[model samples]
Target chain A: IAGITQAPTSQILAAGRRMTLRCTQDMRHNAMYWYRQDLGLGLRLIHYSNTAGTTGKGEVPDGYSVSRANTDDFPLTLASAVPSQTSVYFCASSRGTGELFFGEGSRLTVL
Target chain B: GESVGLHLPTLSVQEGDNSIINCAYSNSASDYFIWYKQESGKGPQFIIDIRSNMDKRQGQRVTVLLNKTVKHLSLQIAATQPGDSAVYFCAERATDSWGKFQFGAGTQVVVTP
Candidate 1:
């Protein structure tokens, strides 16, 4: 059903470069989220949107930003990537108070 | 700072034996919890979930136990198989934000045949 689709499954970028991770959900969920996964650390919320046109900061939103202009797409942007930003990024969507459906994930390596 | 954590970083279980993965949450206000299984090179998959009001919930071959009094959660798998090997994570839904969830570090379950 292609519940959620993420682009650039893997990428290697130089530090100080700009990158954007694309996420799209066909489920037509109301809420979308961006999370990063690092070794020894579970998923940490970077940013989230309860609905279209509303974005909120999450636990770790410093090096990241997100926009939810529509219900089907919520993209995460890294203005200037750093070495420490090298981690796997996941996009998730869910209806209110329901289980989340996550994307396959985008693995970005900042060198 | 409230957080969710796992009791063990890794667990090894033999095939056909039952396995239990433990989790602890510091947020007493959390009312809903979920268990997810993540395999290699993939996103976390929903396994089971339990609400704070319920002590235990069972699925086909899995059971989730929630201890709100102690703020602990557990996932039990019966007849463990090699296919069950993966990293399991426990997450708590934020009371303030019904759609927001905080996840634990995770426990790697390795089922030996």
Candidate 2:
């Protein structure tokens, strides 16, 4: 089963450019999340959606925005990417508030 | 923002030995905690989890302990193997939104054969 998949396994973007990381889950879960992982730091939640059509800001959502248009897809967009936005991004989905199934990750490098 | 900090950045242990990793969270409203193992270039994988109502919970060779009183959490691995070498992360869920999970810095484990 394709639990969770993220598009653009890796990307290089110029600073100030806008980019969207695509995420899809085959599990049909209600809760979806976006997180960024940096060296020497754990994954930090960017945004989360408890259900379709609802999104909420997470710990680090200043430069990121997420939309849950449907149950299987939750996309995270980075507006005006900066050097500090360079990190590995992961998308995860879970049923209700239960355990999460995560994607391999999309590595973004901002120059 | 509340911090979920780990006690150690790296841990080295011999194969077959038991290993313990510790974490401390600053949020008092965290109701759920989870341990995740991440290998290089991979997303974190759930190892075990413990709720605030329970002090300890065990899985195959892994165990998670939660101390709500101290806002501390720990993961214990028995019979550590070389395959267990990876970074371990501890995460706590906000009571307000269960899907909002905050993670700690993480501890890298090196199991020497």
User: Which model scores highest in DockQ?
Assistant: 2
How far out, in Å, is residue A23 in model 1?
0.2
Best by lDDT: 1
On residues B1-113, what C-alpha lDDT tens digit does candidate 2 reach at each position? 99885354889999999999999999998998889999989888989988888999999999888888889999999999999999998988877867778889899999998
Tens digit of lDDT per residue, candidate 1, span A34-85? 9999877899999999999999999999989999999999999999999999
Error of 1 at B108 (Å): 0.3
Off by over 4 Å in 2: B1-8
Worst 10 residues of 2 chain A by lDDT: A37-46
What's the lDDT for all of these models?
Answer: 0.94, 0.90
Per-residue lDDT tens digits for candidate 1, residues B20-67, read 999999999999999999999999999999888899999989999999
Q: Which 10-residue window in model 1 chain B sums to the lowest lDDT?
A: B1-10
User: What DockQ does each prediction reach against the true complex?
Assistant: 0.59, 0.61
For candidate 2, the docking band is: medium
